[model samples]
Target: MAKKKKKTVAEDDLSAEDLGVVPEEKKKKTTAKKKTSKKKTTTKKKTTKKSSKKSDFIQSSCNVGLVGHVDHGKTTLVKALSGTWTEKYADEINRGITIKLGYAEAAVMQCPKCNRVIAEALANLLRKSKKDPKGHCPDCGEKLAFKRRISFVDAPGHEILMATMLSGASLMDGAVLLVAANEDCPQPQTREHLAALEIAKIENIIIVQNKVDSVGKERAIEHYNQIKSFVKGTIAENAPIIPTSAIFQANVDKISELIEEIIPSPDFEDLNEEDFLFNVARSFDINRPGISIDDLAGGVMGGSIISGQISVGDQVEIRPGLKNPDSGKYKPVITTVKSIYEGKHSLETARPGGLIAIGTELDPSNTRTDQLIGNVVGTPETLPEVKNTVEIETHLLEKVLGAEEDISVKPIAKNELIMIVVGTSLSAGVVSKIGKHNSVSLQLKRPICALGGSIVALSRRIHNRFRLIGYGYLAE
Candidate 1:
């Protein structure tokens, strides 16, 4: 065999065509393609990393619920302040009562006497290099900012629908207790709702003496004083009592002002994130696909964020039956938020004082009406447990069962089934312990929904009557 001549450095690095395999340009092109492939792989990794960071920065928002007496202008006031019709349902409109939870947005408008319209107009013209701009009294021109968003859940106030009212009230951060100026004293529902608020431990309240336009200033003042005296030791004791007229829009600005003063911004951090829970006031199927369609068709989770925040794409865990199912084990189903809407506006995140509609991937059949709804989307380590025992501090409404002595001596064992409402979540649990301190521990027959540390109401079933007796908190 002839000895192969030693190839030079350039000769050894042969192109594809060196051996008549292909064109030299094609070989170069192939090599370039390989390099580009590598670049693309590197670029793809970078893009994924960037996308994740963006997702991490997006936080959740809040929710609020409206509670008060029927015909107290709760619906009208909601329509006026939120600029949305809460009672859109035919049944609700026809009955002139909020049978179900009616959701609306609370629109924030600037104080006509405080906004700087002229300055804003001048700034706009300056940017456009235009002068002699048409001007108006800045002090009188109130504008709505897109950023300042609020929501409300108009709850029913019918005497028979106290459960519904309590359900709605449980999900609120603060409450706007509407009392008509025309009434000499608080209605039964008014006192009931106030009691419910106290049970839920809702600390922020703005007492609105609605229909003030119907009453002259002198009478309105008297009405205000009466209400002031009524709420003296309660949450509304120090609450601003603004006289308002939704029909005439008189003192309407005052409602907005009070809301601004009372409703804390959504940006504020909740000190109680670990125990954050949202109660579902209403669940409906939508005619929409995927998770949203499934969620809507299955069930639209409606409630207020009692604490913490919830965002789209969050993985939530549903504890059905509050108690262990037939298997004596709590059933937990995990799902993601397909979509989130506040009133009608689609949102990426929701805070603690607005209404939230969560389209979930859960099968409606599996998730019962009053199951405990919570997000397993955050730190699982911090997620609350589906506890059987809950500690409570309760208040008994006089018309119903009178006192602790009224608790049935027989057939009603401690830890027996009793209805409880916290936020919008409602379910029946067994009374685990009744303390001498007027507190009780409920070993919920089912895992009634709740956030630890959240205030919950207890109503025991005695014969044919449902008695609102006490309030409690979820403990470890």
Candidate 2:
């Protein structure tokens, strides 16, 4: 009976094979994905590949000036971005107002998933699960894109520093106008700065409603509406108003995004080919009193390049240089640039549209105390001609700005000496001739380094201060 059962089982197995039912293998097999070492090795290789690709990023390409009323926190906003407070002087810190043009630089990075400058809190929330320092947000699982760096020019908002603000305007590709959320929409300097921007033709602007932490959301919205009405029919009529708390850094990421969107780097084919034109605003003697002659550094000139490019070791000339006592002619100063500095970053070459400080091989005496201020620097024999007599087409405004007295603008009369600001160059000019409407010529007291088609700001001493009356372009 046992032999008969065994024979039957064997017959059944043979019959199943004949029916194409295959037997399964019982040996255990391991997958490469489950091997811990192999998985870690793959991840490490991917991370290294991403790290190598992130080294290329664009630095700052243009300068953005900060403008607003005094004590409105323009410098504070700069600090929030750069982590460096721009108020370097003791008086500025004590007085709680920016006295001069303050500069600071910051890089704005964008999120790879959303392509936005994520608010710090939001970014933290999104990246909570990611262990990689510069890796993607865990929520979106995308990396961060490093955008360009930006330089901020924090200009004084005091009524008296209108000329300095105007000069700073010349250096800006666009401007960020700050309006305090705790105060009224248009302060005196706020109005004046907007007017100055109009005169300077800086059309690209972003209005920041600052100090949001000091006000409720309702109050902030009221200020926002007020700002809209204030800028109605103005150059900033179409500009975006971003609400932020510069002190607490609320919505500061939006400021970076707005800047990138509004003021892009201007495209100019002649960035490297044209003759360089640098308007000197500030100069310094970096030497200490105890420094020896061998250790004394060359003089440094600070300002922005208006056009073209300059390089270290380039032979340059300063227009309206020291007057030659014997020849009675102003001989342009000939010097070589020992180094170039933008903010704290040193560079071998500098292009137009950012604050630049040139270290020149000249006596510290010439550049000390801003002695070389109001001068123009450029390649030798390539600078615009120095003009003591300039022909201008005047365009006077309808009303005087920032004046306690509500006075209508008076026409520029013959022999009327007025303050003229061309680029960063300041001069006093007498109206030598007046033709038809908006047509007038001036004989300047201090010569200006100017070319045809240069725009000049005209200021008259209204009461006690030089108020911007109008602007005109030089006749070619």
Q: What is the TM-score of each candidate against the true structure?
A: 0.68, 0.81
Give the poorly placed runs of model 1, Cα more than 4 Å off: 1-64, 111-113, 116-147, 213-222, 270-277, 288-299, 306-312, 321-330, 349-353, 364-382, 388-417, 430-445, 449-452, 461-465
Candidate 2, number of clashes: 1
Q: How many Å off is the CA of 472 in candidate 2?
A: 0.6
Angstrom error of the Cα, residue 11, model 1: value is 83
The TM-score leader among the candidates is: 2
lDDT of 1 by residue, 1-476 (tens): 22233222221122111111222234345557766778878766866886675454322233355777788888877765655666755566688888766666644434354552122222222232343333322233334232255667677987667777777665566778889888875766777788887777777788878887777889988887789788887777888877777666556556666665676655556534634455565554332122223123333566655556677777765544323447776655667776666544456776666556676666554433323343222223344565666776654544543222435323234756778776555667777777765666766655544456666666766555566756666553
lDDT of 2 by residue, 1-476 (tens): 75565344221122111111111110011223334446777767865775565334232578899999998989888877666677766567689998767777666567676666642333443355556454354345566655666677899999898888888888888999999999997888898899889988899899999998998989988989999999999999999998888887777767877888888877655766778888887776655444456666677788887778888789999998866669766768999888776655556677775666788888876776666778888888888788988888888888887775667999998998899888877888888898876788888877878789978888898887888888999888
Find the 10 residues in a row with the least total lDDT in model 2: 19-28
Model 1 residue 17 lDDT score:
13
Worst lDDT run of 10 residues, candidate 1, spans 11-20
Error of 2 at 455 (Å): 1.2
Q: Scored by CA lDDT, what does every candidate get?
A: 0.59, 0.76
| CA-RMSD of model 1 | 17.5
